[model samples]
Target: MLLGCLPGLAAVLALALCAGGVERSVAASGRQVVARPAAAHKAVRPHIVPRSVWLDDDTRHAQPPPRYDDRVIAVFVHHTDSPNGYDCADAPRIIRYLYAGQTGSRDWDDIGYNFLVDRCGTIYEGRAGGIDRPVTGAHTQGFNHRTTGIAALGTFTAGVPVPKEMTDAIAALAAWKLGLSGTDPRARVRLTSSNSHSRYAAGASTTFPALAGHKDGYMTSCPGAALSALLPGIRETAARLQGRH
Candidate 1:
């Protein structure tokens, strides 16, 4: 009897280990069932360098408390329109320069973009808000609310080679951020225009790609033709990263 009981005990231990340490219980039918762990629906957040890496106390501007929305349903992609030949080592310096220009010349309270990606595929936290929150950015004039802005570090005009690393980083960032709200990157989201300056008049309801170029909501040829052409692929990649079939 002891030897038979030892075999049964070994089998029960194996089942527990295979079930990932979850508890097992008997079902109404009298069959033992293993309770598996719940599946994770959210994507893993990608690595992002904090604003302090680039902005120190001396350069930090005095801005109002970061504004937030209910959730981030869309993302706007943009190009800095700056030089593309910058070394990755100088990315922090370049970001600082852009911050100064936006705050000094443009008179903006802080950097407009919620995040920035360099040519070397490094992601940097922009603005003065928490990256995980749906911070209202100033990148898109009419659709700033309920959206996040990601600016590619350099210019990407027609015929220019958009770095693969940069695009991959953007996709990863989008997958995680949009995944927070269970948003599909390939889906079209309806956004109400807050400013009349956009392509759509103020208060107009329009549908745009969840992952869109800055030009989609605005009149400017922002993000340039080269990067604009890559939006579709980026959307698909982001969806895949989020485990969408």
Candidate 2:
């Protein structure tokens, strides 16, 4: 009987080795590569954020995202704050910004973020999910395991202020997303708050990562001076949503 089971045991041992190797491979690649959505497949959908919620209608939406996705990490905020005006009237304008202009040679085909928050505080949606699926995009520098993007208006370097409504939108969206991840069967997420240092901070990832500034992880200055300064406040608002406060 013992010899009869030897082959099965060997097979089990081999399988375990393969599983362990895969885990290490994932960690080595970092969350970004593993979490990024495959560009070959994107859904056809539009998620629009009205102007009342925006501080200004100066930003555009990108192409749709995957039909169904759920792995999101931290929220990355930046100041499109571009002096050069963009189409901004609607999502098509956004698609132009992401695909046209200096595509950074990547020809990404869409905006680099998952969402856009304007000066007025209204949130215009970007990166639609595929056919009732979840969505993911490129925004955060690293830590894409469960990350989303939020681009604001005006240049903090140019002396722009991060408004109260902007924070409100961030909190509202973060809360909504966190709750969604917990219940959404389509999205297989692992985090809830902002905890990624590459994207958030140490305490931020308690459940889900916290809202963060683009400069937090990247060397280039982005999200603007005023908005970057408000990272903590944004996180607090999100925390309150989860009863962390």
Candidate 3:
């Protein structure tokens, strides 16, 4: 009887040892997981919109590289004030034409807007400055500093049909650009007026929508009445893209 009981005891001891080993292994794994850096668990960045540079026929140059602002807190939407009827394939040509007029006729150092979008929903890099940097644009009169300018390729006066593709692209661009600074696209930001040309006096601080129309900061009816009407929808779309839904 004693010998039989001894064999059973040995089996129990082996099972207990196996259980202890498993618990130890699990504890070790937990420790290793806890040792990982906090940054390793950070959320992934949001999607970035694709953009194109100057086309083959496009003449792109900035004699003196465009100046840069510290950061962009707002974005102003505009219309190129060009013809609305054109083939999407000819977007590059259209852009080249605009560039020539600005740099050649206007004698500006570079294109005014930081970005341009075609009716086909294509986004183009403008202004000869680094797209990711806060390049000061010549688009807005007094709100250039800490702001970005995105021009829609065609005219959008009152009653003109605004393309869904164009508006969608604009929303995407606004969301991504503002996300770099952790700005909420639906929020309002206060900016100091740099010139008296705009509605506000120079050095006067005023609050404006994060995603604004050209006319929001200036007296010109740029971006058109048709496009201006879409600003609210664009802001909502941008905010949704930034995870603010």
> For candidate 3, lDDT tens digit of each residue in 1-245?
00000112123221110000112223654564223222211112333332344534346545695688888889989887667788988887776776665666556666677888889898888776687899888777778889988888777878999999999989888888887676777789888988787788889999999998878887667788899999999988888877776
Q: What are the per-model numbers of colliding residue pairs?
A: 0, 39, 0
Worst 10 residues of 1 by lDDT: 1-10
lDDT of 2 by residue, 19-80 (tens): 00122225664664344422221212223463233222344334343533354435556655
Pairs clashing within candidate 3: none
lDDT of 1 by residue, 34-146 (tens): 68654433578999999999997777778889889999989999887777888998998887877776676556788888999999999999987898899988888788888
Scored against the true structure, residue 240 in model 2 reaches a CA lDDT of 60
Winning model by TM-score: 1
lDDT of each: 0.80, 0.45, 0.71
TM-scores for all candidates: the values are: 0.83, 0.54, 0.77
Which lDDT value does model 3 have at 211?
Answer: 95
Off by over 4 Å in 2: 1-70, 84-99, 102-106, 130-134, 182-209, 243-245
Model 1 alpha-carbon drift over 4 Å, by segment: 1-41
Better of 1 and 2 by lDDT: 1
